[model samples]
Target chain A: MQYQATVTIEQKAGMLDPEGTTAKRALGHLGYEVSSVKTAKLYEIVLEAESADIAQQKVDEMCQKLIANPIVHNYTIELKELN
Target chain B: MKIAIIQFGGTNCDLDVLHVLKDVLGLDAETVWYKQEDLTGFDGVVVPGGFSYGDYLRAGAIAARTPIMDSVKKLAAEGKPVLGICNGFQVLTEARLLEGALTTNEYPKFRCHWTNLRVEAVDTPFTSKFKKGELIRMPIAHMEGKFYAEEKTLAELDEKEQVVFRYVDGNGKVMDSANPNGSLENIAGIVNTSRNILGLMPHPERASESILGSDDGLRVFESMADYITENF
Candidate 1:
C-alpha cells in the first residue's frame, strides 16, 4: 500500500522563536492582532507501507534520526493511506 | 603533532586552521575529506568553520551525519582532543558529541566581528593555557551562533563546569550588549562531560597571529599542544 506521511516539526515549547516573532511583528504592523506566533516545517513524504501504523512508526524513527533535533525541536507525524 | 582537519564541502576555514596548525604552530596538519573513514595516527582533530553542505536543512546538520563523524566520535571517545570552531561547533552539537544547539541569532542576522570571550574553565585541554576568568578576543562569523540548551541541560552543564567560555566585554563583564548572538548565559564555548571535546563559536585561528590583530587565539592551540605533550 501507498502511504503519505505529513511531518510537522517546530521549536520546542519555551524555546526562542525568532522567525515566529519577526513574522508576528510584521503581522502586527499589517494590523493583525496576534499576540504570538510559532513557526514549523511541514514535510510531505510518500512511501510504500503495509499499513498506516507501520508508516507512522517508520516516520517516528525518521524524525528521531534526521527530521527533528530533539534538543530544540518537537515533531508530529500523520500518515494517510493513498490509492 | 599530527592533526586531522576535517573538511566538508563548503568548509572555507579549513585552510585557516591549516595555516594556524602547520604554518604558525608548526604542527603537521592534514585536510581530511568528510567521506574518508579512517582517522588513525592523528593526534588531534579540528573541525574548521564554514557553511558545510551549504547549511542545508540546518547549519551543520547535514555535515554532522557524514561518515567522517563516526571516526571523529571514535577519536573523541579515545580521549583525543577534538576541537570544533564556529560551524564545527554546530556539527559537534548536532552530532550529539556536545550538548545544546546553535540557533539563529536573536537579531536574525549574520554576525561578523571581534568578540571578547572569558575563559570560564581551564581544566579542559582547550583552555588550559588561560587563567580562570581570563578574557580572550576572537572573531565570530556566523548566522546561527546562538547557543541554546534547555533549563535542565543548562543546569547540568553548569553543575559539571562543562562551559568553557562566555562572551564578555572589554571589562570582563558578561553583559547582554556584549553577547553578539544572544547565547544562553552568554555561552561562547562549551566542552563535553569528558572534557576531551571542545566546541566554540569564535574563530581562534583568525587570531593566532599578532599581525592578525591579536595573538590570543594561539594560547588555545598552545594549551592543546601542552596537553598532548603531557598525556599523549
Candidate 2:
C-alpha cells in the first residue's frame, strides 16, 4: 500500500520562535492586534508501507531522526492511505 | 599529520579551510567528499561552513545525516579533535554530536560580518593556543546561527565549562550589541564533554590572514596541529 504522511514540526513550547515573533511584529505594524504567532515546518511524504500503523511509525522515525530536533522541536504526524 | 575537511554539495568553505590547514598551518589536509564513508588516515577533521544542500529543511539538517558523519562520530568518540564552523556547527547540533540547536536568528536575517569573541574555555583542543579571556575577531555568515538549548543543558554546559567562546565587544565587554545572532549568553562556540569536539558559528578560516583583516583565526588551526602532534 502507498501511504501519504504529513509531518508538522514546531518549536517546543519554551523554544524561541524568531520567525513567529517577526511575523507577529509585522502584523502589529499593519495595525492588526495579534498577541502571538508560532511557526512550523510541514513535510509531506509518500512512501510504501504495509498499513497505516506502519506508515505512521516510519514517518515518526523520520521525524525523530532527521526532520526534527528532539531538543527543540515537537512533531505531529498525520497519515492517510492512498487508494 | 593529515586532516580531513568534510565536503558536502554546498560546502563552499572547504578550500578556505584547506588553505589554512595546508598552507598556513603546514599540515597535510585533504577535502573528503560526504560519500566516502571512511576517514581513515586523517588525524583530525574540520567541518567548514557553507550551506550544505542549500539549507533545505533547516540549515545543516540534511548534511548531518550523510554517511561521512558516521566516520566523524567515530573520530569524535575516540577523542580525536573535530571542529565544526558556521553551517558545520549547525550540522553538528543536527547530528546530535553537540548539544543545543542553531535556529533562525532573533531578527531572522542572514548575518555576515566580523564579530568579536571572548575566549571562555581555553581547554578545548581548538582553543588551546588562545589565552583565557582573550578577545578574537572572526567572520560569521549564517541565517540560523542563534544557538538555543534547554535550561538544564545550559546549566550543564556551564558546570562542565564546555562553552569555548562568547561574542563580545572589542574591549572584551560582554554586551547584547556584540551579539550578532542573539545566541544564548552570547555563546559563539562550545566543546563536547571530552573537549575533543568543537562547534562554533564564526569562520576562523576567513580571519586567518592579516591581509584579509586579522590573523587571529590562524591560531585555531595552529592549536589543532599542536594538539595532534602531542596526542597523536
Poorly placed runs, candidate 1 (over 4 Å): none
Model 1, docking class: medium
In model 1, pairs of residues that clash are: none
How many residue pairs collide in each prediction? 0, 0
How good is model 2 by TM-score? 0.96
DockQ per candidate: 0.78, 0.81
lDDT (0-100) at residue B138 of candidate 2?
91
* Residue B96 in candidate 2, Cα distance off native in Å: 1.0
lDDT of 1 by residue, A3-73 (tens): 99999999988888889999999999999989789899899999998888888899899888888899889
- For candidate 2, write residues B100-194 as lDDT tens digits: 99988887788889999999988888888999999889999888999899889999999999999999998998899999988999989999899
Name the best candidate (by DockQ). Answer: 2
The candidate scoring highest on lDDT is 1
